[model samples]
Target chain A: MLSQTRYRMLYLIGLGLGDAEDVTCKGLKIIKNAKRVYLEAYTSILTVGKEALEEFYGRSVILADRDMVEQHSDVILEDAEKEDIAFLVVGDPFGATTHSDLVLRAAERNIKYRVVHNASIMNAVGCCGLQLYNFGETVSIVFWTETWRPNSFYDKISQNRKHKLHTLCLLDIKVKEQTIENMMRGRPIYEPPRFMTVSQAASQLLEIVEDQKDSDKESLAYTAETICVGLARVGTDSQVIKVATLKQMTSLDLGRPLHSFIITGHLHPLEVDMLRQFTDDQSILA
Target chain B: MLSQTRYRMLYLIGLGLGDAEDVTCKGLKIIKNAKRVYLEAYTSILTVGKEALEEFYGRSVILADRDMVEQHSDVILEDAEKEDIAFLVVGDPFGATTHSDLVLRAAERNIKYRVVHNASIMNAVGCCGLQLYNFGETVSIVFWTETWRPNSFYDKISQNRKHKLHTLCLLDIKVKEQTIENMMRGRPIYEPPRFMTVSQAASQLLEIVEDQKDSDKESLAYTAETICVGLARVGTDSQVIKVATLKQMTSLDLGRPLHSFIITGHLHPLEVDMLRQFTDDQSILA
Candidate 1:
């Protein structure tokens, strides 16, 4: 029902976590008829690449990297003044705060825009059989550096545990980030993007737990034997989910980047019923 | 590509919070090709109903009430054993744990199923410009009764506030709930479904705070002057968001049901930038 009479529009489309087919029909319709499509590839990624998306959507999508989106967004908006342009974001359009900035810019420019929502891990983690309502604060697990190791996120998890609520830990992804020195020298050199694996996150989490004492003053909030769930590439056919001890999680093969971890607390019986199937207690691998 | 072998399938499709168009293209395609589609009406509702969904989807949808789903689910899955069936869930399929039980049922019946994810209130609250990641445990504000005024959910919000994390209060919806006498009499009489408005929620919240005081004689958790956000009919064209004090919020008119409130703790500069626009500071009524 879209009119042929073109109106200048900027569509922020959510390409769900899976392949192109995962894009909603309405979102795909807008993409198919879009003047241009830019895939915001920084915050997260799809299981498939641009080629697969192009083949499925039948439109060549331009990759809008961090620099393009954060520094040169005017360029992304330039075409919006003339024709309908699409900014396809992985997961929900507002999953990343940056997208909201884009919407603000469009509003300032008097360019009309619309956001088409899709599933984000913030909600999709319910697939792990954890009660979505039981989840407390969601915290990010960032990659640790030798001198820059920070354990603040673990405190958030501790707070959730205090309330007997589940905690969803979003692993970090550093994409197209410039080296500090390189940035200072006005150089365009960038480090290869790094994504935290579930194993790495588990190891770092254990380290933090070792440092923070628990209520007993002898143990920590989470230990090696604590039950945890590691999810990799959710929303894909090859999606992996494992319920194991924190120690076992370090050895599990989740198969890809874009991983998430869950530190569970008290669970309802129904939850226990659904989650027991994935628990390491029932597996020889433990 | 789906194989055209005409296999019996149970598709747990997510009809996004909006109308029929909110159903993903993938979901719509399955609905079009399926032999039956049942809309689960108890958990939540879309902006449009069966008639509008039928008009937009070009297919008739059977209304699956709570009784049919909880007691007589076999009736829903009966057709699935012979042909493709669609069980349309509002928002994401796994948003409610009850739907997970449905998956368990489908598995028990040896029925194959797939969950097509869509935007749920869990993630759609991002529209209010609050960083979804920064939100802590979500709480539900239920209708208070003379003898059954349990305020346990308030404690959860208090815990989240202790961590300086935002709390998303999911206003309660009572659908087809029967009175104790009617249920005991085996009568079909039921109380009309009730959705707690933001105003009602704020007033109750303030009363609880007045009753629960901290060790130092200070009011626990939130006060009447505490800032809060009220969102009504989210994901619809008429979605309204207002920011005001808890006392100020108790009188604001946000129109119909399906309202959610945010008990904000700490505000990031960017979140403040976006939310300030909705703040009552600029209101002439204030």
Candidate 2:
């Protein structure tokens, strides 16, 4: 049972993508009652602006940038021993591994904490008609360098395909990233990072498959003709889910900064039925 | 742009697992404005009692059972064409594949629809520290019968293992189920069915693994000592997540009707850290 004591702190609140109104009722109650509310902004972005959240909740939200939470967590933990403080996150609190560290810290400090859950993109991708349980080991595809191109994600995708399970590829988002020059000069120089788009990811994946074939690592590897799904702005009013071949998706224009790709392995009848509605051409499924 | 006139016909609203207040702000507005509201009671259950929802919403909710939805969808769809009808589903409207069919039907009839999303157990399972994208092919484990035991789930688990991705097993729910006698006699007879418990599922999985090993089909297989996570009443206030060996979890009582399991495959450093907090023995990872 949760104590009614006002000194208790709640950490890691998942604000479902979209708007402040997306917060669960339990999350809202915690935010309203907390002595201070901090939004962790570096990890992910909410579709709606923070001011919109302030107007809806009628409370000023403190921004908890990466530096404050990562480098200076003591500030948030100081009054948490006596006064209630809440750390907000987009999506489910534990969706990212970093927040789990905060929970462990709270446990070590003997400060009781509660997690307010919300919708996450993890399962939201099921809206495209894939079974949530059938997705195998999700891998992230990061931007490749001219000299340092990694192919571990290719191996992971190959493994998923062997089992005939869906592969959910989380596009990389680089925020507050430091450049090599900044590290060398001991200066806090930051470079504007990029979020990988679905089209770019699909093209890269095709290239990796072709590379494997050329190296004789695997025969009959996936190609641009492979069926895939491109999703943009998931969990929002303007959310779009489209089904296309890898070749088709490579050129398909899906507006937005955050995008994800689904490389399907096997399809159950029900899943195929669901995907059919989202596709413009049925030949892609073939 | 969504047409205002379309808003009058069909509204697909998500009722979060807890109570009526768990519905998003947009959902509440649609529900209040709806001339009639139907609660989908088949796919999932809410933690809060129905009475609590009625008290909070100040409206009586018409329950829509499986029969009503499958056999009498016209009742809901017919009214939607003439009045503002709201269909309330636990979790996001698209969480279940069946709901998408309903929306497609409404679309075929030229009934404009809007879906308001909410947190569902699909992503809620990420609270266990497993990457949402890392999960492969979610499968349902049904209660076994003496002569009709099925071990097809083993294939899916093996597939996940091959890819080193976590597998989320959604235990079978037997709500409003019929008995074998009713089918043979062509009578309206029903028997109270059972919800699969974590212990039962683990026991059956062990049996399958042993059987497969005996047949030499798979020399190596998961056993009672396999690491697993048992979750009960996910998305509820009393939700419990516990990590233990399959042998230990089989005898551990979770104190709930709805239970799910996560069979760990490969663990990342961060995943190991997160699981440490919930494991029965912290040194298991070592």
RMSD of 2: 2.9
Query: Which candidate number maximizes lDDT?
Result: 1
Q: For candidate 2 chain B, which ten residues in a row score worst on lDDT? A: B1-10
Report the C-alpha lDDT of model 2 over B1-286, residue by residue, as the tens digit: 1233445588877786555567776677667778888988877777776677778777878999888887778888986777889899987776633386677678778787766677776677777877676677777888888888877887788777766767788788777777778888888766675678888888888777666665654444466667899988776667788898877887877876668899988888878877887877876678
Candidate 1: TM-score of chain A is: 0.91
lDDT, candidate 1, residue B59? 82
Model 2 CAPRI quality: medium
DockQ of every predicted complex: 0.53, 0.51
The lDDT values for all models are 0.81, 0.76
CA-RMSD of model 1 = 3.4
Residue A117's lDDT in candidate 1: 81
Task: Give the C-alpha miss distance for residue A138 in model 2, angstroms.
Answer: 1.5
CA displacement after TM-score superposition, residue A80 of candidate 2 (Å):
2.3
Question: Residue B138 lDDT in model 1?
Answer: 84
